[model samples]
Target: MTCSPDDFRAAMRRFPSGVAIVAAGSAPHRAGMTATAICSLSADPPQVLACLNRLSSTCRAVEDARFFSINLLATSQLALARIFAGLEGGVSADQKFTAGVWRLGVTGAPILEDAVLTFECALVTAHPASTHNIVIGEVRHITGEVAEDALIYRSGVFGRWTGLAVTQPHLS
Candidate 1:
């Protein structure tokens, strides 16, 4: 039997994911959206993948410009994430940058200055599946800080890394 959308979504939500923003284009035509489907693909050529909804303006911009940036959010940036996700009504397409400091990357995509990590990539390819496009890109530039904590999402709730870890016992 085919899985129902609600069931699929519920199951997927159990897996905690780091929050990020996929942004494209420059001022006046810039578009961005909160995303969680980003991951490293390869290190040889420094590649990564970010999935964007096909109908999102950011996705269309990336397609046309052939580039994009994945800005990984820190735990303190939940408000920014919400704003970029369009959850905050009345914020227009171009005004999203007003919520945070942004700069143009080497590929001309908007990059969040305060992101825990930023990956500026040149679009390599995109594969369409259902309502989203799996956009693959080759990393051209990156900047990050290791001390920053990350924002996480799971089961419709937002959380953060508390920097807690258990010490491992010695093993032979």
Candidate 2:
């Protein structure tokens, strides 16, 4: 049960996760970040949870905005994800938004129009998790593109989901 950080990374590499960008636009300091630490938190009211680093520029955007949107990237969107994730400081946050195409979600967060699936939500709750904040959001609107394959993250790199049948029968 007790694993070092290296062990934690190794364990996580086994569970491939869908790649997404969480974005908000309450200020000129719009927030967007590549994320794989996303999960469903509720069903009845439709909620989602995303874990965020406290010092990330994306965190500041969420802290100031009432709502945010999740952009599920397709394989082609990998470049976009990297751009947002690569921005290293406060001065570059706004410029990152300019690199992608977006539309205002119900709460004004920018939803990447080319995303395979998108979610807009109202902030509902947050809890501290050691070094990251687990923020929950109540879903307000969602859109999807069934034909596009999803992007995935595993083994410290980005890849696209093939959507092939699981003939291997392995849990992962």
Q: Write the per-residue lDDT of candidate 2 for residues 58-137, one digit (tens) a residue.
A: 77677678789988898877778788777445436767777668878777888888889998988887688888888899
lDDT of 1 by residue, 1-172 (tens): 9999999899999998999999998889999999989899999999999888999999998998888999999988999999998899999687998998999987788999889999999999999989999999999999887467889988888898665488887699
User: CA lDDT, every prediction?
Assistant: 0.90, 0.83
Q: How far is candidate 2 from the true structure (C-alpha RMSD, Å)?
A: 3.2
Q: Pick the candidate with the highest lDDT.
A: 1
Model 2 regions more than 4 Å off: 87-91, 164-172
TM-score of 1: 0.93
Model 1, stretches more than 4 Å misplaced? 169-172
Best by TM-score: 1
